[model samples]
Target: MKSKLSFLLLSLLFYHYANAQTAPGFKELLDSAMVRDADLKAQQTRNKLTVLDQHKLKDVYLPTLEVSGMASYLNATARVISPELNLQPFLNIPEGKYNNNINVSGFSGLAKADAKMLLYSGGKVRQLNKALEEKRQSENILLEKTSDEVAAVISRAYDQLALVHQSKKVLDEAKRRLDANRKTADKALGYGLITPYDHKKIELAQATLDSKMAEYEGKKELLLTQLEVLTGIDKERLRLIEPVLVPVALPAPQKTIDQRAEIRALDHGINASGFKIKAEQTWWIPKVQLMAASYYIGLYGARVKSSDNIIPPIPAIGYPGRKLDWKPTNLNIFPMLTAGVGFKWEIFDGREGKHAIETARIDRELLQNQKYDAMRKLTLNQANNQSNYNIANSQIALKKKEKEMANNALVQAEKEFRYGMSKSTQLIEAENDLEAAELDYQNAIFNQRRAAVEVMRSTQELDITKLY
Candidate 1:
């Protein structure tokens, strides 16, 4: 049964390869996929955030400038009284001259420019800068990791599409052979050389093949669709370029776990957490800043003029009102410049700062533990992938040998049947065996490639440039 199945599968595979057409290369497919994959596009965009972070880091110690202005109007009124007494009648004077009423209104405006720089922050500035740097490092590694994952997806999808296409061709060939067998059985039955039961058996087998073909055809359509979606190629235009067969080298064992982007990202996170702890501890220390500012105030409609005044004479003394001098001297605008230093201290904050420092410390420790765990798991995974790769390589050799033996058997069976020395059933069985062996050999090649892909993924080397 296994031999028969292998025969059908091998035939389709051969048909697929023999009739394969020229199509897009792996590089083109990958480039197209990079443009269409939404996840990858988002990650690529996010990768630019690191540049913004770096720019901010560069200005960590630079002063910041701000401009401000405002305008308003004001009104005021005033009243007052005075008393006087005279003993001599020769001099005339007014006692009410000392009394007066005044009213005023004006417009006012101000504009200022200020600059401030951090003089000291108890290492908080340095810690914050370091944190940003670490964050950028983490993001960079994340971008690389996303790229690797996308490459792996494309590699596997391409291989599967190729395999399915080959398999469909093999199935078509199998159907043709079954049709021929059914025709032969019909002829034998009419000549009374074979029993009706024998003819029915051939019919039954053909029916089974047709059923299997239908199932495979559906799968082939799905595979084609997947290829279309992955490569951003039109379904009608998407065709896989044949890949050249080559021996894959065994992956070198990793002596350390730092090669993976995920591990490196974790390391960056640990560094960032350490910086955060430092920043939190700084809350208890004083922060100093230097500041400079220039400002101007202007007034409108604020002029003054001299006013004439007169008063009635009193019973004992008489006097004339004199002209009073009224002048505005502050109408001229002036720019005031000032420079100073400022300091701030949190003192205490209900233990929130302490809790923050503790939280950061714990987070750093957690990342360290996570790194250790990842190293162990990744090491094991690498070993397993290597083992699978080796196993797949060996399977190809075994399948090749099997195919050779099956081919020889089929030739001998063909000759014997022609000479009336072998039964028809034996001849057909030999044919099936040869076909099965061939199929196994071809599948073994794909299996080996997939195993190598796994090894690359484990080692963080699953790049598009390494596509088979």
Candidate 2:
């Protein structure tokens, strides 16, 4: 038979989950998805942007300070302190020549410090901060939406698997009964108690039973495969613990539809849109900042000769002789600090900022409307699904009663047939009726269970965290 499980295996994605067990019976699956689900991962990353924006707010509150220094070789012209140039009468002799300036190779160093503090920003910082916070909440809402969706999928898969497995017992019993009937038909024909046509009829009934069994088996495998993927279990070894059926409880509903993750997400989006409008509106405000820098510099000049104190560098003729190599401190600034306040005042644009503000407002309004629209639609969906579930539940009860009656009638009919008090066609008809009742009851049961799962999803009660 062609495998019906192909779609189950076709999904090519996985989320990491800790193998650590939760209390009672919950898998770490939900907790793991919080960190490992791709969408959640992305959303959490987006939430970090808000934290960064919050830090930026801290930056605005604190003064900016910076320290910088530089150390490098600098060559300069030699300085000559000549008595003639000084015109000092007391010292006619030439004074000592020393190049205070950097020589052929000299260390040039400087250190400076700077600080800047913001004076004013016309509410732009606050608006921007709010916008960033909105974005962060939007990310959280998005993660919640993803989580709700995944939970619904898991519930559906579980329900489907349960339904298919439950039907297997019914189909197997039917198959056994059909086999026994077929054998009886064959023996009766050989003993001349049943005609060939009667035997053929038995064969047809047996064929139908076989087909039903095959179908049930196929569906069971398909559902099992889908469930395996959803629950992150090995298909071969995966065994569904018996489902904890939720007894029907009267839901304490909120007057509004705020429980749905989608609505919450939309609410966050609305907030974001509002903040975007605020951000756009504040574009006219001036930006202020503090700038600070510190540095160290050391001077390197003439070298001290170890022997004759005769430095080789003197530009008396064609040669500028020996130059000094100073210490690293002489070339680098030990500490330098500079502080200033910087401001940017907006002048005029082509009304682009105004238009952006208008656009943001429009987007906010649109999303607000969309949110209500979505809520209305979802509310109607949930209502209809719940109604359908109630109807299916009623049908399950009715079919159960009908099955019980059919079972009793079939037993009586078979007893009558064996005593030659009933016709072969009557016996077959009773058997068929019993089979139909069994199928109906089973189907109703599955439908009720499946619908119950849908109801749980609608109520947002499928969180694996709360499940055992």
Candidate 3:
């Protein structure tokens, strides 16, 4: 008895585990899709880029240091001439041979380093930083928007899969009813109570149900494939459970619109544009900076040559020319250091700044217009979605009642046909009506759930964490 009880307990546990593995809840599907969605990943990357841009902007006011070095060969030649004078008696030099030519050549090297820090920019830097910060905020909003969009898509797909699952159940039941009717018809024909034509009609009804079942199977496969692609989950393992059907309360249109990610992103964009305009307008104001620089200059392998034609020429004696040569030497100069404050003001830029300011203003205006248009459209969407939810909610009740009536009618018709009191055609009609009613009821539930998702999305309340 103990062994039997343990086996029974194990069997129950296994059954529960199998069910859990097959049927994924709506929130679980959403979580998986959020992780697997390519668009959301790309948007997340873009948001990271905006964060880097903000960090770059933060460094703009910091001092910038630069070091540079240069090396090159230098050559120079010069000639100097003095007023004509007779120097033969004083210095014993010939007048015509006096030549003053000089040459210098060397390799020169220079190294320079400078640092500059902005002291004042007429608030341009501040405005630019603010604009970048706003841009980052806008990017964050876009990320949120992308996430919401992904979640909405996943919700709809999950709802579709659930609908298909429910639909297949309806079709299966219909097929079973047709099969039972076919058996009954066959027995009646054997007893000569029903004609062969009526038996064939039953077979035809069975065939039609089989066709519909096949069609629903195809639809289920397609929906499963879509879900697999979206959530990166294997279709074979995915069996979706029906999502909860509940209507969301509608908030004020303007209030909801203001909370929407798109509207908030546009607002951020407008603020960014305004900041950019202010930054552009500051182009006329002088920008002051603290500048410091150091320079080093050195010369190596330097040589100097000089020649003078001051020796008198004598025909009977040999005379050498007067020339002087200086050996190569290295020359180093002390490093030069300087620090000062400077300001730059653009007096004119061919109206570039003006045009930039105008462009920024236009961008701000465009965003404003977009926000206004979005508000109008979102208001309409909110109203429509609320109405749809209400309609679907009403339809659910009506469809449920209709389904109950159809089920009752099918039971009555089956019993009548079994007793040879009703025709096979009436039984078939009853079965079809029940199938249609069941499908309609399920569809109403799906529609209501989908409408609720849309309402949450429009209000920027469709957070996966919250939903899960």
Candidate 4:
């Protein structure tokens, strides 16, 4: 019966194995997954946005150019080339009167070009550039943060996989022992050396073993799926290399929070806010621009001749020789040229600019306070993780000791039962106690591993560059 049950269990294992998925190790799976991980992709996207934002700052300091044209016919306007209006003081007397003359009907056309390049904005551009650099640095820190988180998750998953495998191995050994014990009981019962109750107790213990095996199998499947999610590897690509059981070293109590990424981000934020304050204060100063431009003017206008509105008369005495032919004017094109510099002194804005600078100053202070706040939080969290890790390590050691003693007691029980000196119930109880102790030890190890991973996450020292 023992052989038959072993054959059946082996067959089931083989069937499951044939259908089970295979996976690569944590590092290899992470390598494949980093390409597809959404968190990494988001961080990369943020980095690109930061780059674009930095490039956009250049436009604030660069030149602006524009072109335009205006054409209109007026019922009354001035002539451009009138001698009196030409800035010749002696030609400024009447008709061609003020160097230009008013006509009851005329038109004018203009093509204008203008350019302005800022020579100075009172350090606004410089301050903004500084702020942008800070922003970029902060984003970079966030990238590191994401990478660390990914590494920690992979670590935890690998730990779980290891624990399951180890526990499963221990359970397999227990199962084999129970099967052998049941065989001995069966032989003794048939020889009338033991009661049927003893045989039944042995069978019950074996059944417990089978139940535990089934539970381990289910747990293994669940663990595999969880690992798959963490690494982002497809079902086929993920494998777990034997995980290292290296002990974690406790962090020194004297380590400060300055090296942490959260604190760094806070520092950058403070710097960025300082620059923001400078940028706002720059708005109170004068702005100077250098400008030069040239353009072509083309005029097109038509006054439909209303010759029918002309009244023919016979007033001949005033100008009998003045019946001259009327002349027609045509549109002409000409070149327009210009050059200049401009200055704007914003002497006052009803205190708006002052308030703006004041507001920015307040914001700078706010960021400083936030930085301190973040520093406190970061230090607390790191300390807590360190403490947890140390506690878990101690717990693992203690549980390992407990399991050792339990195993020794169980060994003695088994030996006594092999002779005629021990109750089947007492032996089974000792055996169960050993299994429970082993389970507790395995759990402690798993917890210790999880805490160690958390420590790495807190320190931002997890190997996350591969996620890039």
Candidate 5:
């Protein structure tokens, strides 16, 4: 029988431990948010766009080819007047036999292919490519920044939920204490040692405790809804565990600020702007290219008309009306090939290039200024967070002591009332003190955790690995 009892006890302990381990904690929730957060996903898409832009810039230096075809019909007639006896002396033809009159008609078609390869662009292509590369780097940095922001938001929400959970525990304990006291008061009233009003006071205290618990529950529901939206998780499945408080350590303030993703992104922005300026400055330089083409042309269904006297009435010629017909496939130019070098220079463009160069320069200057301002602000924020963390740590120590003292006072009050040496009101006040102290301690812990988050965020070190 003893062995069976021991085995059952051990099994129960193991089951409880397993459930605790299975509950999702701060790190797990943060990981889920990182994957599901809509803002982070949007930033990732923007990064992909930058990558595509880079590819487009790379293809600008490669050759381009085009092919085309055309078909049409042509018809025409002409009349000419000249000296009448042009061939009489040479061929003994009759005078006035030759007259000038011409007529023609035809149909034709054409096909062509052209290719061009860029040889030079006065270094503009190189500059633009470099600028695009810098832009890609900046986008990657922004992605890191977005991830950090999401993590910070998840941390705050988790902290708030933990606070609510801790408050509920305190309230429950207070209710239990009140119930035990009520039972003792009932015995005292039966012995005619206490008044009925004292018993009624205990009931009122229970009612107030119920109200506070209801308030905390409402807060928890709202927080769970927020987590559902941020993490794309069902509220029913989100099991929150209390976070363990640990000491936070950090490096020198200036060094930490320098490593921030925002700072790095700004640096890339400045570099990209500089490259753009260079690209615009080279606009006056002409672009050089190698060009080549091949054309195929064919004419078909050709016919000719002329005066009848020009060709004496020969019986061998069977055609009438002095008309001649040509075969549909008689005319063709199989390959007309051409190759040459070409250049394009914009000598004047209403100062467009000049304005573009100035605009890029202004952007670079703005980024530089913003970098300076950001550095200053980051330094100040780091200092403030550090100070807040220290204050919260101190408050935790003080509140812990206060809670211990309040618990001792409550124990003494309970004993005094049972012995008929004190009133029920004294016991109730002690219970309230202990509950208040417990909540204050929990709040202190939460504040410290929140401060730690802000500090790590400023340093860009708020990843799951470091946070845990």
Candidate 6:
């Protein structure tokens, strides 16, 4: 008995696992799509770029350090220094050698280091940094807008696929009803209660339902393939579990146009342009920069040999006999320091600064116009979505009423057919009406959800996290 109980429990566990493997829910698909979709991943990468831009702006005021070094070999022709007339008479030197030149030659080395810090730039650095920061903010907002757009696509696709899935179910049930009616018609013909023509009518109806079911199956497969690609799931294994939607109260809205990410990004862009104009205006302003440098240069030059030293300098008589020593001051060292400040004023640039300032002003105006236009269009879209939502809700009510009436009519027609008071055609018509009404009701629900999504998207309130 204990073994039997264990086996039953295992069977139940396997069944549960199988059920779990059948399909994925809307939330799961959405979560997977957000991470796997290529476009969304590209947008997310911009968040890292914003961080890099922030760091760049944060370090804009910091000073920079630079170090430089150089070494070179030197050479010179022989030279002889001419003796003075008074010295020549004392030393008794020949008059021919009096104008002789002395030889001079060698290697020289130098090393230098410097640092520069901005003392003042007429607020140019500050304004440029501000512009970069605002530009980064604009990019970040644009990234968020991309995310919102992608999220809306996922929402709409999921809802449309769900609607198609529901439609397939309705068609399946209709086919089943037709098949059962065909069996009844066969029995009626066997009993000679219905003619061959009536039986053929039932067969024709079955054939029509079969065609519709085949079409719906093809459509369902196509939709499943789309979902598979979107969510990065295997096409063969991918299925979408039906979502049970509950009523959700719409969140309180801000001014839709103002809160939209597109508008906010445009505002950031305008602010950035204003800062750029200030940056350009600083072009002609007096600027101050603190500069400091330290350098060491080793000098190496020929000196008179100790033995050749005399009151009057001697000229080189033979090259092999003697030559000046060639040498360097030191191997490697830097021993010098200097400090100073600099001021610069570019008083003229052929009116370039003026042109730049004008360009910035024009860009600001263009952005202002664009923001207004975007707001107007978004406001119009918001109104339309609200209208659609209201209409969908009303249509749902109408569909529900139609379904109720069709259901009642079906019951009445079934009873009449039972007593031979109604034709099979009348009963079949009632069934088709009931099926169509249910399908329309499902469509109304789907349309209502889509409208809500649109309203949220236009208002910049569509948070994927809360979609579940």
Indicate which candidate wins on lDDT.
5
Better of 4 and 5 by TM-score: 5
List TM-score per model, in order. Answer: 0.73, 0.66, 0.83, 0.78, 0.82, 0.77
- Clash totals for all models, in order? 11, 50, 3, 11, 0, 8
Q: List the residue pairs that clash in candidate 6.
A: 78-103, 79-101, 79-102, 79-103, 80-100, 80-101, 80-102, 81-102
Tens digits of per-residue lDDT, candidate 5, 1-468, equal 999999999999998777555667666688889999888888888788888888887887799999999988866665555533364555564565445555555787899999999899899889988988998888888888888888889877877887888788889889888889989999998998788888787888889899998999899899989988887766766654555544445445444788888899899899999999999999899999999999998777866655444444434345332333334544889899999999999999899999999999999999999999999999999889889988988988999999999999999999999998888899889989999999888888888878877877788877455556
| Cα lDDT for residue 324, candidate 1 | 34
- Could you give candidate 2's per-residue lDDT for residues 184-282 as a string of tens digits? 666667777767786777677777777877887787677666655555555554453444333243254433467766777678778878777777876
Better of 1 and 5 by TM-score: 5
Count of clashes in candidate 6 = 8
Task: Decide which is better by lDDT, 3 or 5.
Answer: 5
Query: After superposition, which runs of candidate 5 have C-alpha atoms over 4 Å from their true positions?
Result: 1-21, 76-104, 232-237, 240-254, 304-330, 463-467
Residues 250-357, candidate 4: write the lDDT tens digits.
444333667778778878878988898888887768888898887764334434222221222223434222211233465555565677888888887788887887
Ranking the candidates on lDDT from highest down gives: 5, 3, 1, 6, 4, 2
Best by TM-score: 3
Instruction: Give each prediction's root-mean-square deviation over alpha carbons.
Output: 10.8, 11.4, 6.0, 9.8, 7.0, 6.3
> Which window of ten consecutive residues has the lowest lDDT sum in model 4?
305-314
Candidate lDDT scores, in order, read 0.74, 0.63, 0.81, 0.71, 0.81, 0.73
lDDT of 1 by residue, 337-395 (tens): 99999999888789998999999999999999999999999999888988999999999
Which segments of candidate 6 are over 4 A away from where they belong?
Answer: 1-25, 76-104, 233-240, 245-254, 298-334, 408-430, 463-468
Measured on C-alpha atoms, candidate 3 has an lDDT of 0.81
* Candidate 1 runs further than 4 Å off: 1-22, 75-105, 119-122, 172-187, 210-217, 234-237, 243-251, 284-286, 299-333, 345-353, 390-441, 463-467
Model 4's lDDT to the true fold?
Answer: 0.71
Residue 123 local lDDT, model 5:
91
Over 216-288, each residue of candidate 3 has an lDDT whose tens digit, in order, gives 8898788888988888776756744554433334444344668988899898899999999999999899989
Backbone steric clashes in candidate 1, count = 11
